[model samples]
Target chain A: MSEQDWRAIRAEAIESLLVERGLLDPADVDRVIETYNDRVGPMNGARMVARAWCDPDFKARLLADGTAAMAEFDFGGAQTEKLVVVENTPDTHNVVVCTLCSCYPWAVLGLPPRWYKDPAYRSRIVREPRRVLAEFGLVLDDDVRVRVWDSSAEVRYLVLPRRPADADGLDEAALAQRVTRDAMIGVAQP
Target chain B: MDGIHDLGGRAGFGPVEREADEPAFHERWEARVFAMIGAAAAAGAYRNADQFRHAIERIRPDAYLCDGYYGRWLAGLETLLREAGIVQADELRARIAALGGDPTRPGGARPAEAPDRVAYPPAGEGNRRSVAAAPVFAEGDRVRTASFGVSGHTRLPAYARGRRGTVTTWHGAWVFPDSNAHGRGEQPQHLYTVVFDGVDLWGAAAEPGTAVSLDLFEPYLTAWTAEVDT
Candidate 1:
């Protein structure tokens, strides 16, 4: 059967199960899941990055220790692990991927979107970071050393991409407006 | 037994075929289990004895998957208890009352906080030092990664340990606790960086200028000068 057919079958099965179990109201679950997928995923991490850019001290703390650094902004909720923010400077560019699994800093960053944790992305990115970033439309010059961090341990890392050149004078909230989750992962720059 | 964070480069398992939709079943199941455990303990149905024994039994299964499973299980348990009306605010209050101020253990009235070593401090604050942060060596200082073989959970990746590197950075002290949570108690040790030249790590074929810096716990390191440079 086609991929579309399989997806449809799976959706129907899940809907039937939920309805029968009374664990969820079908319409409400659909809405809740949609909202969570769209709003509560990468956007959260983007906001944290913007906040860090606007505040130097906050950025310093984030670089030093990610979990505590994130709590400063009160960004994470229950699922968020302690944040470990890795920074990307001119000399060194940091990229994050879970080689072993799709482990991410979900508390501050929200959820790991589908693409970030894909097997294709995880497997290829670690061994060939420069090439992978290029595919994501990020091309770093030879001078910049790419450091790929594997969040395979207790410490989850966030990439503090250098503040965008055009973002000068932007306030915390305004800067946050421009930061995308992709930027923090070094796959895309704001 | 294996710790939750121990899956690294293990071979042989083909990707388990899973449905594209319906929120990964494994993820949901694990979350539910964690939540149930937390709720059960909170309701006084299980004491520290039960909680630890269960944790020990459940801890070693697929390490990569267990962390999220346990985390979600705790969440599910909390949600289930609240919904079932087995616990209310007053009951929560009473449980604490019964424990009489020491809420550190399971069923002690207070919910168990994430253990100390695993708990990071609030942002903008210095990381809590556990005696593992201080470095006995400095940059250009020669040292050897511990030759000790891996047993249970170890942070020393197989490829990196035992290879010599320089003390490039002194990550602040941290409590090793020997285990993920200091629940096993504190085995405070200093963390340090031993920078191994690419040539050292990959051998003669390594790129000329490449170097790998590793953050190592103190126990995993030892002082070695040219005297023992074999």
Candidate 2:
């Protein structure tokens, strides 16, 4: 059998072991998977970002204390208990990474992307963020101060990418459509 | 510990690659492993979240790299199961054989659980803790990260060691991973957002007009006196 096949069998064996011991129920596992896969993800973050773009007061609260501001939308949970939102101004561009582990803001952004968890990105982004971001097709100007936030502790970071110049007339929902996961991660512009 | 899992500032891993249309999970096994980890934690199989993280860090360097994210997670879960005395090697082999795999494959014996470790908090209880003592350093204070040689789990990355930075924001107190990873109680400490100049971290190789910010706990920092720079 292929390595993949063996892995599947190994996983099944462990699951059965845990179930037999009353430590786990297959139904509970399914519920956990569905929660992250469907109920949580980038859309939650996009809605918050869209509201910030449209409303000045919400944006002020979000930048001041992301964890408290998220309560207004009833949107904070696991992996984001203490949320911190960094804004990207014309002179400053912000990015987020976790050098120790893939400590992502899961409540808002869902599971981290493959690249976000990859060793190359983890190792190099803090040392050379401009080059790393450039490789992701985001070439920042030399004058823009790049701020790389490494979430080493419990506090998780979410980058509020600068709203595009052309998105002036868009409504909150329309503005939300432009906020992609990569943009919130500070690798792309919405 | 300065293990292979601490990848910050190390080079030669190559460029970051993104999938064309990356799914939330690459495969069914990945999803199963993810859920299994949650189930294990909920079952009180782990002392704390830090202990689970240290399990993955304890992986043999070569083997750790061989597997992807979920794969490393699987290895960690197996390690936890064995260490907790919940699963034995013979049982694993027998189950594998029953499921039609080669039982002759080498497997190590189960390890005895550490008797001195602290118990994990109930499933939903987070790491946040409230303390009456005020934070040592306030926002806008110049501080220097403490340089220590610890052979245990620490959130302080090697790249940021011994660097001088400013406390940009105070995040209140949080569970210190170094103590918690060893089955120690949650010795929560004041945490802050320290922003360091890129040049201070990377020296000549740093990009101009760039800064690296880290959420650091109080024990990792001290006041950066002006005399220290001179």
Candidate 3:
């Protein structure tokens, strides 16, 4: 090749060095990519929300100890150990953003949406949350408090939106299907 | 350091591009780079989360904005590894030259070796741990931020420094990033959720009636004094 992606070559060089040193395995790298790509996503979080919707005691544990509560569903990994579940009632709506960076609970949300990592979102959401919410097509009532939790520290945030009225009789699986990733991140209501 | 990465409230960057059915990685290289960073960290060449993050902050302001999200991660990963002597700059250069000469360069045949940074201790295991320092404030306590001219890695974002806010929640003691970022010991301090009025931070730029808040470590704050607010 006359010219190429320097970053790609640099990455390859780094991997080769690690492989030569016996510190990194190519297979392990493939496994990691597979885990994030196919195995993880909002479904894990939706399951947790569904359990909380149907089981009051489980919801208590989820709000109190997110990591342990998630253990009920066997969902815990990188960036998810210290999760703070923010419940959204009719009076309060919460949205999460990592102003410093896109510090999402990757294990639950899978990779973050590009919008979550956008520079504009990082700056605006905390200052003009209502305006930003409206842009996302969510218009909160004036009385409802819009709380934007900035991930300035290690703690991750997950939104437990209020269970919908018609969803009251649905079983956990059906309720889980109703919970969207945007609702879990507090940008939309299920 | 007031790097471009601390992007709260600064302007001119455009709209949030919400993709329709986005994939985990946009390029094959991105996926490889992501895996490489994680694997190398697990293999013992690393920085703790705070120190690792500071590496991203330490990036030149222009490059921080110019680089892709994971591209910045690759940059930070390389910077930390190079600084720690896990990877040699010259060897990387020569290997890049070789690969640039041939895009299909076979894997694991590189002439360079990443030195063992693991023998010392791993960095980037930044997590919650118990510490002996007594917390300086608590929830509901009015506090004033201390203003300092730090030209190094700092968790106290420039926007909120020297501003007064009420402590809304005590997140318990966590690693003080200001100290930890410099390879200094974890002088753990109480981290709190400090709620500040929008005007306090943004003034004319703030949306009226909106308030912004963030989690701040204890070292970055002090007890509120009536004289300071006015």
Candidate 4:
């Protein structure tokens, strides 16, 4: 616990205060920090989307078996274990919302944005998805069929955002970098 | 008995505001509370995730929405820990005082553990499990959700109750949350994705071709008959 932990002094001080206050324990605090630090976030989901866009085989496997295909990229954990990938197309747009609560695929997209968890979002998205999406700056065509997926329970859904036109010459990594968390959540286009 | 937590299509909560870049834990206390709940679950302090959610659902309607997200998490954690006998109420009070906050108001009484409480599972796997029973409804079948008010935990949203919709897909049978929350049993039931026309749920004001498709358990729905009730 010496020079090995650069902020050992500060960390120890905070832990001692927390323990003294009976709010938490020394070891549990460490575990808490560890969990937050290991997050794979939307970048991991982006990698999956980019690879899928580049490879038909990967795309088919991803659309068919999200969990297994995800494991191929070595991204597995709590909520990531069971995921249903919903793809966004020109004619049909898929939007994901957990009206009951903020039940999202955290493994791929990370912790839901505060907006996603807001009661306003949970309530309105299912009822008025176009209005909600428009507020998010995503305006769909009147012809496009908007499918709002209310993940009210177990299986989570992640949108495979349509690959952008300018992405013609980009490779997998560049395409992955272009994939934003909002796009994966189906509120924005990549 | 429809709790405020069942909010799906009620009105005027406000607009969704997106933050430019949101961090996982906004405050140190938030992180601590989040980890404490996880650790408590890891230490067998509570029955299951549904039980924890039920505890949150049981929060007073006024405070349910008032207690912000992590604030509700803190409140719920306090309630569960005290109820499970893992931490004393006074001990929590003292800690709350030490943190310069009032502990006297900690979301009311300490809830009791479920009568059928069992040992926690090894992994992070939740109460969800497979049910081998045949489904009563299938994709493309019109079904009407049962509009029963529950005095206890339920996954059915208030707006969808009594509305009729077509089953878009049968998501197999999964652990029933309503029963699982009470330690009644896993009681796995068929889960389906039901799609409702906007007007069916929201009346004539809804957009012309929009619809809301939600995943729901079989217990929440009934077979819609074509014959009109005279």
User: Could you say which candidate leads in lDDT?
Assistant: 2
In candidate 4, list every pair of residues with a backbone clash.
none
lDDT, residue B177, model 2: 86
TM-score winner: 2
The local lDDT score (0 to 100) that residue B152 gets in candidate 1 is 35
**What would the per-residue lDDT of candidate 4 be over residues A1-190, giving only the tens digit for each residue?**
2321212222232334446646566577556656655655787899999999999999999999898888898887766546889899888888888776678887787777788877888888877888888998999888988888888777888999999999899999999999999999899999
Candidate 4 residue-wise lDDT, B1-230, digit = tens? 37677778867987887788787766665666666777667656676667777777767777767656766666676666666676666765665555544445434323533344545342225535666678999879999998776766778888888889999888777777787777676788898889988889889878656788888899898888777422
Q: What's the alpha carbon RMSD for model 4? A: 5.3
Error of 2 at B158 (Å): 0.6
Using all chains and alpha carbons, the TM-scores for the candidates as numbered come to 0.57, 0.94, 0.89, 0.89
How many angstroms is residue B190 displaced in model 3 relative to the true structure, after the best TM-score fit? 1.4
Error of 4 at A160 (Å): 1.2
Better of 1 and 3 by DockQ: 3
| Residue A51 CA displacement from its true place in model 2, Å | 0.6
lDDT (Cα, tens digit) per residue for candidate 3, span A71-176: 7778878887578888998787888988887789977888887778878888778767788888888988888877777888777889998999887678999999
Evaluate residue B146 in candidate 3 and report its C-alpha lDDT on the 0 to 100 scale.
70
Q: Each prediction's Cα lDDT score?
A: 0.52, 0.84, 0.75, 0.75
Complex DockQ per candidate: 0.10, 0.73, 0.55, 0.36
Residues B1-230, model 1: lDDT tens digits: 23323233333332322223333223333323433343344444333221233233233344324233333233333333333354443544444445343223222112333322223322232223445234676666778887665433345655455678777656566545244332343355666656666556557754333344555677888887777885
Judged by DockQ cut-offs, the docking class of candidate 2 is medium
| Candidate 2 local lDDT, B57-175, one digit each (tens) | 87777766667787778878887887777877679878988999776743222232343344656333688888788999998999988787477778889988999999988877888
> Could you tell me the TM-score of candidate 2?
0.94
* Higher-ranked by lDDT: 1 or 2: 2
DockQ of candidate 4 relative to the true structure: 0.36
The local lDDT score (0 to 100) that residue B199 gets in candidate 2 is: 93
